[model samples]
Target: MSGLDIDRAAATQMAQKYRNAAEDLESALGGLPASVDGGIASGVLADIVSTLAQNAADLAVLSRVMGGVIDATVSDATATDDSVSESFGGLTLPGEEAAP
Candidate 1:
């Protein structure tokens, strides 16, 4: 069977990119106000913006969490791979029988 092939470095880079996107989103949304000073139209616009901001904040948090999860998962996978490799250090493959 074909084995799993994960690029640990690429996964790490993707995780970092997610975190960076989160940071960028939060930074961009930091100064938006919940309410504005105009009339009914302004109030409606503010409400929309407020809702969007909240959703964006939630998305940012999710992105950061996903990044952390990816990093942790990759680390765990690497550790498990290392442990498995070590466990099989002296073993021979099925077809590579030793001379009697």
Candidate 2:
């Protein structure tokens, strides 16, 4: 009934969606042939590779969005905490950190 409760619920749902998308990407990647045979047409192989690449890109974007939502929810929950401070030592805009 409160804003925090709603944010928590939404964060949970976003996490679940991200998990499902990751699983689907894994399954699709696993289903692809390890190597294409000489008999197979190059165009077919190219198409498969293209599709896989697109799926990977889509998953990456979904992950970014989900991460943003989770971070926003956490920030909202922690807004009143006195000990917490916002800092970006290594994290980039895309949710990854630069290697030290």
Best by lDDT: 1
Tens digits of lDDT, candidate 2, 1-100: 3443445666777776776676677667667765666465876887788787777868866776786677676666767443333454445667666757
Give candidate 2's error at residue 38 in angstroms. Answer: 8.8
- Runs in model 2 lying further than 4 Å from the true structure: 1-6, 37-40, 47-51, 54-65, 68-72, 75-100
| lDDT value, residue 45 of candidate 2 | 82
C-alpha TM-scores of all predictions: 0.83, 0.45
> lDDT of each prediction vs. the true structure?
0.89, 0.67
Clashing pairs in 2: none
Candidate 1 vs. truth: CA RMSD? 3.4
Local accuracy of candidate 1 as per-residue lDDT tens digits, 1-100? 3487779999999999999999999998977764687676887888888889999999999999999999998998899889988887768879897544
